[model samples]
Target: MILFGRVRMLLLRTIAYLIDSFILFILVIAGFQSFLLITGLHPFIGRHLYSISGNELHIWLFASIIIPVYMYFVTMFNTRAQATLGMRAARLQINTTGRIGIGGAMLRALIMLVPWELTHIALSYPKPFWVAHHLQSPLLYIALSLTGIYWLLPLLNLHGKSIHDFITGTIIIRWHMPPTKKP
Candidate 1:
């Protein structure tokens, strides 16, 4: 396992994140559409989702969208590959003593979801509602701040470990296999 420098790791991780985000976006859209179909809701039906005053259906729908995403990370990270699709594309792997256990993988996934979940909450509040509720500003600020810190934490460490990595005792490394000999 070859450890990457901070800059290289950052670049690779960023690209991996972009790739993962695109894939997750597609998955989320499909899941949402499926949920609508199963519930007999029209695809074109308009609903006000940009509000904190959403109904239970909205909450359930959001959970349906989120659970699969969380599972995607947890399952992928704990697998023998120890890498997501984007990570595989970038030749990066999660370095651990052995395989990262399910608990560690799940913790890492939850930690990684912090900023995203917070941002989702903050953004769900409409402008007027956010203005009326001063707490929304602080929540948004916290989400943005945490996101920046999470992304930059690796730069502060020699081993390029981020917050989630440190919390879960994992490291990201460049993975290379020896070239196969031709008979």
Candidate 2:
């Protein structure tokens, strides 16, 4: 049975996410180091190798980071576990019958990706760059707003389904153990 209330669910999910994030951070660092080694470039040498101002390079960098993460989520969600490592640690499962298809998994992964990528971009990129490039204020504002909403939406829903859950037609449910009788 599903055990956790919204608060517990949220807390568990947060813990799980932190654990997963830490793991991914390590992977990202390793990947960066590998890239540097393979290309024989100093850490600061390839400053322009993938500039944010260049569309192709920007897309490539985004894709390079996103694709592996996307595959990780999709593969885990589609597995018998039906949960990522974080979800498993939280004792949360994707409440669905049968396996979530590749398309569904991809959609869910992408939905989760948007807010994450947007917030990273908003925080990492300078405002002056956007202004100079005519990207305008609303874009950053929207990204920030959406990032806020993405987290808060779970609280608004009866079942604690976030925006991504709703968009991907997925639900998160917690596992519960039956009570034991005192001897």
Report residue 26 deviation for candidate 2 (angstroms): 1.1
lDDT by residue for model 2 over 61-175, one digit each (tens)?
4665667777888888888778888888778778766677888888888888786666446544543243344255465677778877877777776788878789877788885
lDDT, model 2, position 81: 74
Segments in model 1 whose C-alpha atoms lie over 4 Å from true places: 1-4, 34-52, 55-61, 125-136
Q: Per-prediction count of colliding residue pairs?
A: 0, 0
- Which stretches of candidate 2 lie above 4 Å from their native place? 1-4, 32-35, 38-52, 119-137, 176-183
Local distance difference test values of all predictions, in order: 0.78, 0.69
Cα lDDT tens digits, model 1, 1-183, are 234568788989989988887888777766666677778784334645343342343354357656777888999899898998888998898999998989988999999988877765665544434334636467789988999999888888888888999999999988898799999
Candidate 1 local Cα displacement, residue 145, angstroms: 0.3
Q: How does each model score on TM-score? A: 0.81, 0.74
